[model samples]
Target: MRWLDADEERAWRALRRMMIAIQSRTAHDLAAAGLSEPDYEVLSTLSERPGHASTLGEQAAKMGWSRSRLSRHATRMEARGLVRREPDPDDGRGCYLVLTEHGLRTLEDAAPAHLESVRRHVIDRLSSADLSALERIARKLEEPT
Candidate 1:
């Protein structure tokens, strides 16, 4: 396999830096609002769907997290009244994570600042053509082999 040459390596490093900075800034901003990025994602995702509930496995997969990580986070949030755990009716051994009313309200409060951070760090940094290019590259990278 051909390794990346100097220019490609430099570009890869730049992309990595941008990715890290974007995530860091967003997480920091969310932290100020009393939420983590993962918390925002979980809350928003559940609120986006009907029933406001998803199985533990489903939540883990959606967040690209392990089941244990999801469970641990959910436990913390549950204690804070952000969510609740319930038995999954269809699967005897499975469980669901349901977003509580408090979680929904918290997510709504955080959305504006979260969106502004994203726009300022990423969206506003790119031109329309660059945005399209980024979309294409990102989609390609996400494709299954």
Candidate 2:
């Protein structure tokens, strides 16, 4: 296998650093808003659907999470009055994840701060050309190898 040249290695490290920086900055913002990354992920995903409700399987798939992970997180959210699970009438084994009013409120409150952090840490750092380049690079990386 070929190794990166010094310049390539430096760029690789910069990319890695940027990822960590983005995660940490947004995490700090979320923490200040009384949320963890998992909480944010669950809430944000559910918020995309009308009424903030989706089948458990769909939520899990959309978030790239395991059913067991979703189950565990949902259980905790349920206990906190953030969400509720309803049986899917068409399928005895299926259930719908419903975000409660409290959940929506919390997410709404956190979104502005979260968006600001994202903008500060990522979006505002790039020029339009750089942003376009990054999108292209990310899309390339996302393609099936």
Candidate 3:
């Protein structure tokens, strides 16, 4: 097996720790707005789509989630009146995940605080050069092998 060298190990560990710390802190911040990370993800994703809707498959793919997982989460969100499933006009076998007015309002209310939390946790901590390097690294990592 190819083992990471000392420098690579340090970099990987730092990235992992940073990700976990940021996610934990942001999750806590989102909770103050009555949102979990998944909830925020769903709301934000739907909000970006035309008519605030997208097919479950599409959304799942975009989020890099399984269809079943997204479907289950959608059910929980629906129970809270945050989102609803509507029959897809073009696809009889599928449904679109549509954000409710409540969902939009909730997202609108939560976004400012979320942005603030993000800034406080990461954005404000990084220099322009750091952000550029991070962005380049992230894009490179995201490229399909």
Candidate 4:
């Protein structure tokens, strides 16, 4: 197998560093709001849905989290009045996770600052061409083998 050249290796390392740093910083920010990255993702996912609700399995898939992890986080959120869990009407054995009013409000309030942090740390640092290239690369990497 061919190895990356110096430039490619540098770029790959940089990308990895950025990914780790960004996640760390974002997690810290969310923690300040009494939310973890997974917790934030759960609310963010439901907020985008038609009724701020989704099935537990769907939420797990979207968050790339295990069922047990999602369930525990959902349970914590429920205790905090950020989310509600109920039996899926369509399937008695299934569960639905819904964002509560407080969840929506918290996300709405945090979004602007969150976006600004993203911009300051990630988006603003990239040129338009760089962003397009990154998007193209990401699409290729995300494709099913």
Candidate of highest lDDT: 3
Output the number of the TM-score-best candidate: 3
Which RMSD values do the candidates have, in order?
1.6, 1.7, 1.0, 2.2
Superposed model 4: Cα runs more than 4 Å off: 1-11
Clashing residue pairs in candidate 1, if any? none
Write down the worst ten-residue block by lDDT for model 4.
28-37
**Pairing residues by index, what is the TM-score of model 1?**
0.91
Model 1 has an lDDT value of 0.91
Question: What are the Cα lDDT values of the candidates?
Answer: 0.91, 0.92, 0.97, 0.87
Which RMSD does model 2 reach against the true structure? 1.7
lDDT (Cα, tens digit) per residue for candidate 3, span 1-145: 9999999999999999999999999999999999999999999999999999999999999898999999999999999999999999999999999999999999999999999999999999999999999999999998889
Question: What is the full ranking by lDDT, best candidate first?
Answer: 3, 2, 1, 4
In model 1, where do residues sit more than 4 Å from their true spots? Answer: 1-3
Off-target runs (Cα >4 Å) in candidate 2 are 1-8
The TM-score values for the models, in the order shown, are 0.91, 0.89, 0.96, 0.85
lDDT of 2 by residue, 5-111 (tens): 99999999999998898898899888999888899899989999988899999999898889999999999989988889999998999999998999999999999
Task: Show the colliding residue pairs in model 3.
Answer: none
lDDT of 4 by residue, 1-145 (tens): 9999999999999989988999888777767777777777888999988789999998898877888899988999899999999899899988999999999998887777777777877799999999999899988987779
